[model samples]
Target chain A: MSTIANYGEVQRALQTDTEQILAQIPVSPVTLSMPMDGAGPRICASVKRDDTSRVPASVNVVLDGNPVEIVVEAVGDYQDFKAL
Target chain B: MMVNEGSEGRGGDAEHFSRLFEWLNTNADRLLDDPATNLVAVGIGKKSAGRIDDDSPFCITGFVEKKLSEKEIASRSMSLFADAAAAVSNVGQPKSLDFEIDVIETGSRFRARPGLQFPAAQRGLRGGAAPTLDLQKRFETIRKGIGITNPHRSYPASLSVGTLGFFVRDEGGTTFLVSNNHVIADENKARKGDSIVQPGTLDLTQSELNLMPTLAKLRAQLEIAKLSAFVDIHFHNPQAIPFNEVDCAAAEILSDKRDFSEIARIGLGGDLSGVATPFTIDPVTGEVTGLTRVYKAGRTTGWTEGEVTQLAVVTDVRYGAGLARFRNQLGIAASPDNTGPFSRAGDSGSAIVNARQELVGLLFAGSEMQTLANPIQPVLDALSGALGAKALTVI
Candidate 1:
């Protein structure tokens, strides 16, 4: 199992991976996905339905790492653990 | 929805018609939720002095498309604002709208005009009303500097910087250096309480941004309005939502004698002595019309003049890497001679004052033919509420 702990690894893959380079980096090998479930940012009642026509949008692309975005929350909080 | 407030009267002139403002703020969601509404703009202002019987009654004005007839427009508007105290619960309550709603129909679909407003030769300089501002005194009272972000050892100076628009105290007695988000916050690179410098990075060498003493701490714009009120930031453009009427930011000044009237217009004293309504609209027809004169004093342009062509305009402006849509902005252009402009590159945060010496708006962006400014009323309100200000005042 691999935990790509930080964005640096993803960035490194994009810059040096031969396969990614050949593919012209069209799709990110490691993409970030913001969960939209009840645990995520608020969504309207309509978002639950199969068709999400009514769900509000997310400027995640333009505002991916931008400062303008306030972090609403995280899906899970983690604590440092070590195997004894 | 015109916001070109023509004149400021004595005594009761500073009134903002707070009840109406708060009413609209609290319940605007109902109207915006319906796509069919297509409600373009809204504004508040008094008539020009002597232009009407009494400029005392601060008016509530709104703007929509002209396709709808006089009857249809009024009928729909009344429906939205109907039943004094029922549907829109806050309509008639105390501290709610005390004035009547006047809806106007715009001739053209509002599309933001954008470009850069670097100074230009005034095709010609004509004589007009003599300026009331004490040029030398105004310059002496305030600090003149650039808007830069985090300067460090390697980076030296932040890549972004621009003009220091104005300085004023919030209700909490906290003083701030006012300018655009791109200017003070470096297009999103800065955080609250970050250090800022004058003679901005554009004006200063990287070495200077590193050496210069910090003049102020950054203040979060506080414009992160309620999420649910807006449709979605997840869309093509975000300003289309509620509560984003301006693109202003502030830095808590270390300590300086700064006021909203840091710079004076060519024809006025350098003091925002009072606040006035943004513009006037016809009660029955909803056509916006009022005081057409306005001016600004900026870093690059110095003192320039122009006409308030349109008020309450909803348009998109490009900055840095993306486009941000701004609504309820004042549009100015060189009249008579099609090429006249009011500001330039280093002038993004200058105060937009009317001929009567009242603070009208905050100059920010521009294009070849148009200069854009966030109307003054909303700027003040955003600071007061979002920033937790008690009694914001422009000296």
Candidate 2:
């Protein structure tokens, strides 16, 4: 568990992991959220149900040399949300 | 009669709530780290009905993806200051805050409306190929929230349309229509002097015609459809730092001098007519504070309201062929009272404003769960640089 003091470092690690996951599997929408209630320093990788085979079930990020699992949820098909 | 209870207790409660918030802020990471808590976000709000803890009307509001049963919640024994429980007893509130934590379920994914496509048969032949008298009239009366598009695309199938968010005036007194880069500049494929039309190709009602089958015919049609005041769009390049902070662009409004003066004075109007004039940004952070109640007038959804679910959010969004990562974007979700989503397709260029009518963010992207906006300060700064002016003020 990260304290408020070192929360920045934890967030950076999560972002790096998210970037790596996206690079390995293109077009998978991923996001990071603050520890509001359920989890701290978390990243949610949204994968397409059809392209599940291409995406990992979970990703691992090293925090203080300890590995934490980041879950990749299989949402339906990927949607192009920018143009709208 | 209630005044006999005195103000001391009320003041103590207020101070206690503030301290509780401060404590929560300090230990936020630890509380969420424990999966048993099931909290996705936290804030202070009025206690909802049918809660076990009703001693106080106010409590530490905990937003969760799902709510657990009272039995399960109690079994988990979620404590606020477990290590210092003994010391906290001296405080006003109980050491165990499980009863005080209100759990509310909220969907948290950040994306925009999907699979939005118009029929090719309905494509505008009049605007893209040639402008009609009706479209010319619509173009003259430009206003915010009206549909705008880049008629001249590299490919005939490339149809780009979005709402004109706001009218902003630079230091030079040149007013411009603000919107997303993808809407006006066609995701950087459009040049500075490209023709941008009102009512866009999607909004036009004219019947389709494949009149420009040949290159010569295409050029001739382009010439005929070229409504004057060709929009000048410029996308400012990010300096060294990677990732885009904003998805914004400004199109110079080149209406007649008389029309320009009218627009500058009264400002652009549409569904946003009631929005207060003398535009300003959130003064606290030079942008909107988190968890703000906001509303926007857009092309597709018209007018809608929502609350900022989070801020300083990092998310990857799809833009054509590749995924562009956006940093520090605002995540807005439907307000608790409003059942419908905040935005939909064609609402991309709308402006998100607070209740005070201050420009907070530029609506760009979203999904069913969350709508994303770039903080208005960064947007204004970027446009200011691209326009080569000291500053651009929202009018």
Candidate 3:
């Protein structure tokens, strides 16, 4: 197998782990992309939670000694994130 | 009167009984370490209806290896100290002040039992997620042992006061109210300098705090280093360290409005609100040393007392989404006769103090049978190291 195949195996494993986590948690789900240089995983999600619950500012998942940040969707001009 | 004679007759007996309790407490570890004694619990008790050890009731109940006769216990009691033998071998008749040892079923260390009814405190990640109880009113007073809430979580729910715990000072003389991170920090969902409301959002109704007399805000949530040595995290997740381990938080409370020194109903660990007890920390290891009986006032069960049953306990706990493991945690079980429990769901963030009034541990999480706390020494160190707090002293 080529080096690219090895990276693919690791990425697939992370996706699998992410799936397992999502099934257990009440979180907005998304895939984090690992950089080709293996610097870290960058996370972005266009997910919105509609529950009446006040959610956390950001959720973090650690991939390969680095963090992938999951930002809770932005709502309106009522920006209390800095205060909360 | 007959009562007066009874009391006067065993004056010396009661004194001995009292001293024996302290002796037992000091030697608790030794006693428990041995299975031969079969001693599970020991506390002062009333005179049983038929038992003769009434004048000085010292109930010694446990899973006796064998039903120890009064003579055997008297021998054991005499073996404890030289003077104790005199109480056992009093001429013709034995004074009823010997050992009233009763062996029965096993006793367990009490954990704060949680009752989750409403979707708020009742919400869980998985299976045990059934709504069994109903939304009910909680305490209104701003003191310890009353229910509090973190409105910042977006879901207003009730958690216990866990005492006002302590008043920590920054370099500028600013004081902050302390509790578990889950309580004041909303399980890592709060910003520093934000408003932390006492009586929480779900105490009485949506606006119970609005109608109440004292309204307090939890300032900004302060962070502490997850005692990795005290906690167990699978993957190196910096985020999990703040959310999961050591379960403590502090928000600046205006001293003019509410007193951090004052505990809710129970006065500061026996009326010691303002006075600060000196505690010892291993400068090298950051561990609390030489701690004894500790107390905490919570929202649900009110004032509770127990001994540090175990120390340096490492275990995993579940937050909303996942499991976070912690290490170097202190173990506290229910007091004898079930007076105080370490923590329940609402009981998180209570201050655990010793008889000397030293801040010993911070009550954060637990099973229904026992509670766990992060040692206060390391917690205070974490504040200064990670959160920029210096000269952290309890007011």
Candidate 4:
């Protein structure tokens, strides 16, 4: 019985490892060739809601674990919160 | 209404006529309120030092209000004055009659009988004698400009009954009253010994003979009262720094008896009834989002409320430094009759409070319907450092 339980645990761990490998495969990774002095590579991410009519689109950047969100509106245009 | 005093002879007849004339003058406002009484005038009657006659009855030779048919008004007023004249004649020795009524030429076209001296005639009386309409329109304009969401009391500074003084404190514990440097320095030739009467008070209009006692009383009151330090900047160019903006200065108090915090609380108390709070634009969407509720309390307009229509707006406001770009400016577009979000001519330095009566902005300018205000935190910081006292915070 003890041997059967151990085998079950090993199978579960193997499945988790396989899922992790598949998750990374779908995303792309990039590296900066020449980084500017005070500026780091800028990475932008765009997000859209499933119901486009209900929620507006948004853009965000993650810098040093800090997430800055930008709101884009149809009327007034783009605005950065911190800058205002 | 006419009271007829029969023709008679008595002493002090001139004095009696003068009293009657004064009575008519004082009732001008009330008479004007009557729709039937189209034209009202202040008539001065003069008689050659000692002659008397029946033709000498008080005459209504001119018009004061418009809309009263000229012919009809003339006949009616003449009859009324004739009645008054008869009453006066009954009281005193009959005297030769000479009388002139003062009326605004624009509204009242009735000419002054020749050879009778009268004060300068008031203008804009004819088609312009729409005091009711004028008052209503002016009220509406102010209400729209301030974004009236709620009704409040407002009195013109030129016609107010009290004085409003601003005070500031410095780090050294020195308190000062912030006002136009001229207000204290007596620039524009305000004599040093001249009294500084509060705006809208009788003292402001008192003659020298009547002003002495009032001035003396005020002086004595200042002697015992907590006097705020006065600063005289002496900046007197009306064109350079308009009185509205240069109208700002601070008075320092020696004691910490009052501060911005106290003012905030007082404002909140005044706003016990909750009000709508307004919000600025969401920087991300450029969309106006947030609370749309806003309110303001000024010396002139006691307290008013309105809604915010735009946020983060960039505008060109002409201030002391000429036209400058105002970024992230919040615009409150109020509905008609709501006097909030903006200060009028006399409300130059009033602090703008939120629905919670929290200090949020300072009202400085506005149009007939839109008002512009500066956020409170920045003003508090700037003035706090300059005042040397702890900046009052909005709870």
> Which number leads on TM-score?
2
Q: Using alpha carbons, what is the TM-score of model 2?
A: 0.51
Model 3 CA deviation exceeding 4 Å by range: A1-84, B1-146, B155-163, B206-245, B255-266, B271-289
- Error at B218, model 4, angstroms: 7.2
lDDT of 4 by residue, B1-395 (tens): 21333332345456657665675676545544554444454444422211244344443332444443457756765333333343444533213323333233346455767663445574434334322211111121111111110000111122222113233445464544333322222223232233322322322324522443444544332211122222222232545421121222233332222233332123322532222243432322334334456665444454556665443333334333233323333445554566343445444445455555544455544544455555444444544554446743222
Cα RMSD, model 4? 20.6
DockQ of each: 0.02, 0.16, 0.04, 0.02
- lDDT value for candidate 2? 0.58
- What is the CAPRI rating of model 2's predicted complex? incorrect
Tell me the tens digit of each residue's lDDT in model 1 across B1-395.
Answer: 22233323345444545665775686566565544456566555443222333545565554566646547846776433222222455545423433445556687668888643544564235434444432212133344322333332213323433555555576667666566665555555555655554444445544544564343221121111111110111112454422236666666655333332333322233555566575654422334454567767666555677777644443445665455545456767655642345666666777777777677787778765567787787777766664667766765
Q: For model 3, what is the alpha-carbon lDDT of residue B18?
A: 74
Worst 10 residues of 2 chain B by lDDT: B222-231
lDDT of 3 by residue, B1-395 (tens): 01112432365666756776765576556555654454554444443423445444444433433454557857765222212222233422223434443344434543568754566654564446432221123322234434454454453233323333444667877656666666666556566655555554444443543444232232222111111111222322655433223556666655444444433334433543333233333422334446557777666555677766543443446555455555556667777855434555566766777776656777777765557777776677766554565667665
> In terms of lDDT, which candidate is strongest?
2
Query: Judged by DockQ cut-offs, is candidate 3 incorrect, acceptable, medium or high?
Result: incorrect
TM-score of model 1's chain A, to 2 decimals?
0.23
Q: Where is model 1 more than 4 Å wrong at Cα? A: A1-84, B1-160, B205-243, B256-269, B283-290, B335-340
Taking the tens digit of each residue's C-alpha lDDT, what string does model 2 give over A1-84?
423213343345543544554554454454543332223333334446566576665555565676555554444444444547
lDDT against the true structure, each candidate: 0.47, 0.58, 0.47, 0.34
**How much DockQ does model 1 earn?**
0.02
